[model samples]
Target: MKLQVVLVLCAAFALSLQAPSSQECWCELQSEEKAFPHAKLSMVERNVSDCNRNVTPKKTLELESLVLGLDRRIALLHRDISVLEKEDDGELYGVLSLYVVENEMVEIQQMMDKLNRTMKGDQHLTADVTQQLTELQAEMGEMETFDTMELVKGRLATQLLKKDLDNCRKSLNATVPPTQPPQGTCPHGQLVNVTGPQVFTGGEYPGSYLYGAWGRDPEPEPGKENWYWLVMMTVSNRYSNYVRLYSSLSALIVGKSVPGNIIIHSSNPTTNTIQGPNNVLYRGALYYNCYNQLDVCRFNLTTNTVSSFELPKGTRYNSKGNFCNLDECYPYTDLDLATDESGVWVTYTTNQDFGNLVLSKVEEGEPPRLGQTWHTAVYKQALTNTFMACGVLYGTRFVSKDVEEIFYALDTVTGKERFNVGIFMNKMAPNIQALNYSPVDRMLHAYSNSNMVSYKVWFE
Candidate 1:
């Protein structure tokens, strides 16, 4: 009886020695699989694992898309807040704009709440939101802290939102417009002040597709001079592969137009995919920043052939650089294609140039190549849009809801630069998303505030 009891006690001691330590044990699927493999499988309830769901490829992509959408909304929110700040004196839109702001603030809060709910299922994504994100969210949620009068008189709440939105831009890498310029002295002479919002046409897709370009071709085939073209950023406000055509300004205004839905290499991103609103129709072809690559793509309407040439290696692409001011960073505006009295030109900023505007001619050829390049002293982030007119590169900034200042200019001919061009563009919109100069009409076509607005450029 004594011997039997000693044997049983020794067996129990051996089992305890072999078992895992309570403090160090973890519930990994791989670790569990390796456990007790020689013994009969223990009955498990097989509950769905939070860890497995979080690691799924589909779920990961969904989270990333959600994050990007939130980032973009935050930017737009900041832009609206800026508009409210401008209108606080009851000068622009009166207190009506305040109602719009309040409504948008509520929508943004709903987005945050959705994100937080989705994050509860994802531990890894929660880490990405971080302490700073939480703080920014809290700051944004304090919209009700101010009463109507306090909010109207002072911009304290708006200022906090602006600061937090800027932080969001930094977190999402919001960095920073187009043109093929002419040669030597342009035919129209030096571009002077741009006057009037001459025409405002909100097309069929108006109040939507807010980011896009609209202008006549600088060098159209004989009978096509009357044609005005528009390419809305239909995909996530970042990509478009087709052009819509209106026979004339009147036709465009009346929304009588043909769909130029001709695919210019829709399958090949490196070829003719338009990535930003900074694209233009020049000399019977559409030139734009190639989607997903740092290259200039020219899609010849005549041949229907798409050809592209790579930009300078270090040249920024994919929204790494953008036209940004206090309110907003225009999305995916890394490469701008513009036309002038001379010919085709492209503009961008490079790390080597340190965010200053770098201008290069998209040299006209079998496959358009980059030509004589110039670097300017003006910071790209300071301006909202840029266009090349008469061989001179002009830049504009948001002055107010009623005025946009042509605050910077670079005479590519003389290599002369100025920070205060002071040539103001009379505004019809709060923000100019796309600005293109047409040598054909001697006008600047601006896609602003969900409306197609054009300004007559006075030239010396």
Candidate 2:
């Protein structure tokens, strides 16, 4: 009905453009420069009684039906794109992206064929219908090229990631033990459960810097055991070149008395600088994803030195695979750096794993390197956030605006997983952007929205 109305208006406007009957007098309204396919407007003539009539041209009604068919096809095409957009398993225009696009193209061709058949031998086709058909043919010509280039790139990424997956499997001749630390290193018993936010602090920059990570170092390098570190994305909420060090929890909350500041030289993304919000301060060094690359960079605050090692090939980075719930995704969170009672670890996903979180130990060495890597069945983007506790990789998803639940866990020792862990985490803010646990305080620190929240963990 709406389409018919639109067609009526256009037909009336077009008809009124004809030369006025010299004998007729018609009312006039505002004129000149109307919208769409028309450069100017003029007074249109219509019988005063035509406004009250319910009559419409048969040709306009026919055009309405044809346009309505096109509308339905356009709607279906939009829904197909939405399905490709909303998946957390991986990125759009990835593995299945090209296939979906190609299928739509085929459907479009079928629509064109049917339209051509219907118009055959109909020499009196309206100009509007002819215009729409010409546009469709032009668009189809452009789409044929899209089907080839993107598919080639997608296949290349898959092949590279497959090689990396094979390398990861070969490196793990033995299981990566649950405990990477030495005997009695973690006096805290196994992390059995986590409680709600015990303390919520909105530092000076509350709500100003949305994407960031803050927590205590489970193991300190020397005299910085009591210090708290914060690293927030400064450039586009995706890149940072410095970290703010607070002496105590109170100092962090106050946002003042911050004398400790470690700056990573060369903020340029192509250099050795911070890239994502998934960074953690561990043993006087900050571990984070390096800028514009697939490498984990370790910046030692005490020594003021930087070391980095490349991540597995085809590992998603640069906002490709991020921490996301159904509603939204935290940008540049492709590589998550975390610390547990056992040791520091990094979690990410690749094409090979189909977006499942992959855990690799960030071993402390002269030139920091990746140690044993373990794979989990939990999809990386499916969950809101993840953390390592006592060699167990735990993932959380949104239960509510103020609540997040740890529903997935993978034990590195036995290579076993549990998907039914019912521990729930309540927060002061709506989203948990970054989460890490500190063995020293036995508290889970989270960067929520623009606030810092801590939760107490209970061990069985």
- The lDDT, on a scale of 0 to 1, for candidate 1 is 0.77
User: Using Cα atoms with residue i matched to residue i, what is each candidate's TM-score against the true structure?
Assistant: 0.60, 0.59
Candidate 1 lDDT over 110-202, as tens digits, reads: 888888877786765557445435654565345334343565436877888999999998979854313433355776556655656568778
Would you give me the overall lDDT of model 2? 0.77
- Per-residue CA lDDT of candidate 2, range 1-460, in tens? 9999999999988887885656877787874533332111111112223322422343333443454455556666787777777767655455587587678878777776666665652443345445645755565554445444477668889999999999888788756756446522335665566754667888868788888889898877676778889988778787888889888888888887466667897554558889988889877789999888899988888788889899989999989999898888989899989888777889999989998889898878878889998887888888898888777788999988856889998878778898999887766678888998887888999998878889877765
Tell me the spans in candidate 2 whose CA falls farther than 4 Å from its real position. Answer: 1-187, 266-270
Local distance difference test, each candidate = 0.77, 0.77
- Residue 307 local lDDT, model 2: 90
Say what the RMSD of model 2 is. 30.9
- Separately for all candidates shown, the number of backbone clashes (residues 3 or more apart, or on different chains) is 17, 0
